[model samples]
Target: MADLKDQRHPQYMGDRQIVTDLLGTTQPSDRNLADLARLCIRYRGFQGARDIQADLLKVLAQWHLTEEQLYAKTREIHTTAKVFATHNDGRDDWA
Candidate 1:
């Protein structure tokens, strides 16, 4: 498996950087964590996007949020993010 922190998908260059920079910080603000949660849902079901998936989950854990809680946030993300809203399909059932 690729190192989650070391691998970045080209498709999400700018989006990944935003999340990565947030992760690099020791204490991300709630708003930043909300951004991470939105991004986490945004990448759901994408192939070769495990790095971002794992990274998002890792940060949630680091901040002491459960996976269930992280996923719960996905529904709101799906409702709000245009990408997730428009991309709904079998691949995005996680939300």
Candidate 2:
């Protein structure tokens, strides 16, 4: 076991390309992730997905938009998925 300070912080976990490529389906690429997020907002009737898209747009317009934006956006979508998943499972918890 390694000390917390000596352990790897996984700086690459948030990388857009890696997440996108690793998923290799819903998002095989960063651009695809962004596009899918947008499409979810445009088509999906899920409020969570819509909110995720909104958050993504806000982050993107911050002058640092890039492939990373897509990754970040997808994570946001995942949050939505979690929320809906819980709700569907008969739980009303969400913030």
Candidate 3:
């Protein structure tokens, strides 16, 4: 099983790309933002996800994302993660 910090997870990698593209960054990649989104989903079944969500919101504020936009994107990521978790039996299948 891939750990939360493991960006090699397909779901995490996808989310990373989504966030990177959304932020419109042409510079070097930074995993912090994407990692936060990954963690939010990785811990979806636990309170940890909430903590991560709060942290992500704080970071998003700095990025100037409107509340509606943030909510939509965050909700989308969370839903995708939930679906992935459900279908994969709560384990990431990178094999």
Candidate 4:
């Protein structure tokens, strides 16, 4: 077996695309709930998936915001920040 130092410290098991998919279907269903829960647990303390985890929790917590409120807020955080990208005229979708 490989030593601890030799082993790869993989990033958290979640990604932004999955988070967006889950957010796309925010209904209170078993699959959605499970996915969100899994994300929260997987990204408990890791900084890489911090925003991804927060987005999951925001839907799980049911904040009284409009339909696109959460997505809009998070989307505004440009791609350079490693969040996600938007294909709008003024955004960097290639980041």
- The model with the greatest lDDT is 1
Better of 1 and 4 by lDDT: 1
For residues 66-89, write the lDDT of model 3, one tens digit per residue.
555544666666655542324646
Candidate 2 error regions (>4 Å):
1-27, 46-71, 74-95
lDDT of each: 0.65, 0.43, 0.47, 0.52
Regions of candidate 1 where Cα sits further than 4 Å from its true position? 1-11, 70-95
Better of 1 and 4 by TM-score: 1
Sort the candidates on lDDT, descending order. 1, 4, 3, 2
TM-score of every candidate relative to the true structure: 0.54, 0.23, 0.29, 0.44
* Candidate 2 lDDT for residue 57: 47
69-92: candidate 2 lDDT, tens digit per residue: 555877876666542222456543
* Cα shift from native, residue 64, model 3 (Å): 2.6
- Per-residue lDDT tens digits for candidate 1, residues 1-95, read 86545334555776768768877877765456567776766776666667778888778777777757755755555566643234545463333
Candidate 2, after superposition: displacement of residue 29 in Å?
Answer: 1.0
Error of 1 at 31 (Å): 2.0
Report residue 15 deviation for candidate 1 (angstroms).
1.8
lDDT of 4 by residue, 1-95 (tens): 95434222154333577677777774644444444554555666554555676786776557444435544444444332443224568843221
Clashes of each: 0, 0, 0, 0
Evaluation by TM-score, superior candidate among 1 and 3: 1
Best by TM-score: 1
